[model samples]
Target: MPTVHLLDYVAGNIRSLVNAINQVGYDVEWVKTPEDVKNAGKLILPGVGHFGHCLSQLDKGGFLEPIRQHIEAGKPFMGICVGLQALFQGSEEDNNVPGLGVIPMRIQKFNDTSKSVPHIGWNSAINTGSDDTKNESFYGLRPTSKYYYVHSYAAPYNPGVLESDGWSVATATYGEEEFIGAISRGNIFGAQFHPEKSGVAGLRAIHAFLNGDQFQSLSQDLVTGKENGLTRRVIACLDVRTNDSGDLVVTKGDQYDVREKSGADAGGSVRNLGKPVDMAKKYYEQGADEVTFLNITSFRNCPIADTPMLEILRRTSETVFVPLTIGGGIKDTVDTDGTRVPALDVATMYFKSGADKVSVGSDSVFAAEDYYRAGEKLSGQTAIETISKAYGKQAVVVSVDPKRVYVDKPEDTPHHTIKTQFPNSNGQSFCWYQCTVKGGRETRDIDVRQLVQAVEAMGAGEILLNCIDKDGSNAGFDLELIRDVKASIKIPVIASSGAGVPAHFAEVFNKTTTDAALGAGMFHRGEYTVSQVKDHLQTEGFLVRQFET
Candidate 1:
């Protein structure tokens, strides 16, 4: 019941801050003047747009002195995005303009060519100082829970700061420069990324901040116990595809042809298959939390079984401990007697083959009644229970790929028809896209919100939501889509598609209620390693899983 004051300057992402604060059960009061900061339980200063203009606005509103006073008084204060940069003495974005100088550092532009400007995508972080106890404050961050970042300049960690990344700073990079993503000074915490825009992980950070001592205890418990609030994972997916040899692959740019008998084959012989096991191994190593492997392909032909791929996966499972959720090309299985094959029996095969979770996609959407009939024939709950008994409930994950459809439109207008001339524009009249399955080959008339409710009702433990429009773009997560789905469902939501950098992960966690983030391209290409990503999240004060020292 704390009244949180969100400092409202002309240059802040007000909406994002408000939504993030509200998500964690805190009441927010938007304040533009200095007097509004008085006696507040907590304070959030969010900055966006131009740096000079933001400082001028804060000065005009007489907030600079009050904010400084609040921090000096040991009040819990969080600076977001530019707000973090503003704490430094100054930034290269506007060198002539001075910052608040709360922290002894200067913001500078990243000149690295390996990274892009505006530091738009998801990136990771690393800790530099020798103090593991201080560094472990950010330990609960899973590799997939990345924060969002959008900036041109950042404050590089100096002697006063404890850590920095290698490529960027403290194992985190923005624009390929080692920049400070987060700076903590006692009760004052600042993040270069928007925690409000980040999904559940961001919210958890906020919740931890609000809870104060309770969160500290939880952190201590996590490091000591190593397992609390650890529950069964449910994940959703998007943009799944196969390599030329019909092996699972996730990439951003070109399509590479798979050659038979190539060294890429796991069999090490003349086998016509790619190595999905190699891909899965990378995911497990990265701390997937869980994965929903959607086979993004035109399912006109019967799904081919990659026996060699499965064998590799089986062999890989002997080493990997994470759960694998497999979806795509599953319809109905029949025996010689014409009796339906049980879901449990089929799931058992996947389990025996090293898959901990079996996700039904096109089969669940296109043949709903038949799918349910099959489920009933196989005893739906019985199947789930059997799998739960066998591998534990945490291993059972159901993936629902639902798209948004406008509900306020006229009945006569075609659902897919574009009334406006520009088909790709983000217009107010065009409210949503209908959920499609069968590799986007079939469209479902149901609204995405409704579909989420339905999926949750179907006893699914999780939902992996993906935006077809945003898939494989390497831009950023579709935050609006994620926000909507997260608001509608109680089940955990794994935001997929459009994860280009570690900062994007931070944004996803800050912006929505998404429990996890799933990406294929950034990891596969060696742009970021799992530890690098996790370290970045930790520096930003996110709760992530950490290796016990």
Candidate 2:
């Protein structure tokens, strides 16, 4: 086995890539400087950031020429995400920044039009070439091989030209466009999707790339959406808070204020419905595609010191096979000992405790405000950048808890206002989604649209769209909020808050561009199970992950 040289650009998920490679019995050596690239064996360039930013870093570190030389020498080389985009001529993301020009094609943003842009989540990659020799990167993958994707820009697929240019393309249709998913050109290969984050199929893809002949064809029955032809996720969200008795319980809140805090519970003032771990396990048993635990009160305390929260994750992961997301207080904090801890370190603790993703709410807004003050600047030290660099952008989620601020006219303020589906009491028709911090206690200058774009550039994988006004109201999801946020950003969005019934879930799925619909109040009140929601989604002619359980 040769040493797999993994390139680090100070922006990519070096940690997750290393873990994936090591899982398949391959030893990885991190390549930082140009000298490391020159001395590389079996090089792999994995990165995710602004297209221009990645290229600038590579050039500044003197890695461009050395990496090109290594690949030109016929060494096995691979690129992932931004790395793959870097191989093309340039990108629409930043037109001035030039790529390595290894391929003549220019990377373009998904031409989704009015649909979802980023095209996140699992999707099948149908191989264009029948011969394995032509499609070596997708060596053992079947026609419907599902790989996890998280990218807004992709290489344009010209089946004729790609095949003639010594590249075999596997394409996926996102909205109105069919873009390249994976490309293999001899020893030079690239994957627009993150193979490491693609789960079992992903692991196999990495293994086959490193250790030849290790790839095993999976059964069709094991595929996520083999029957439906497309994959959509159903998420179960648990709003966690401490009751009056100091016991951590899953609670439901209305309009960003939980029942426990107001002592307006139907059963008790505390609103202690059940334990976190127990409820999580119950949801997992009910065939939930994913689970999210939002520690509503963690904003007031140090999340790292929240032992019960970490304990819930550890215990739940042992039983829950799906992904687990934790939100609230995922920012930098000072410990009781007066030691300041970086937000990255805080996210690391959550990941170590079995959290697949961490949602940054208040911290993200602060980071964006800092960027706004610093001339559209971005620091690598921020929680979003650091966490994404370590765990991949797919692991970092930005929870946007925004409220509708109705006004007389759209142009009254400099914010992007939407015509409200539900008008205000004064009959004000236009409104702007005001971004909030500290669980909606304080509103920020930036709106939801600006925050979404800023955080995406800062390396947030997905956005957990939370509507403060509609939260726990059981009126249904804030469809207006969902549409506005979903249309603004290209990343995957999980529509949250104000889910009342099974029809609400279906409505969001059918009407909005959200990749997933999350429910807390409905699930907590025993109104609908995870399986029940999935069943309803399936019955409505929507694609959802089917479970025998």
lDDT of each: 0.55, 0.77
- The deviation in Å at residue 346 for candidate 2 is 5.8
Q: Write the per-residue lDDT of candidate 1 for residues 462-488, one digit (tens) a residue.
A: 556666666656788778777777666
Candidate 1 Cα outliers beyond 4 Å, as residue runs: 1-274, 295-309, 334-340, 366-393, 404-426, 547-549
Candidate RMSDs in Å, in order, are 19.6, 5.8
Which number leads on TM-score?
A: 2
Give the C-alpha miss distance for residue 474 in model 2, angstroms.
4.9
Q: Give candidate 1's whole-model lDDT.
A: 0.55
Poorest lDDT segment (10 consecutive residues) of candidate 1: 227-236
Query: Residue-wise lDDT of candidate 2 within 128-178, one digit each (tens)?
Result: 653433323354454445666777788877768978876767777766577
Model 2 alpha-carbon miss at residue 416, Å: 9.1
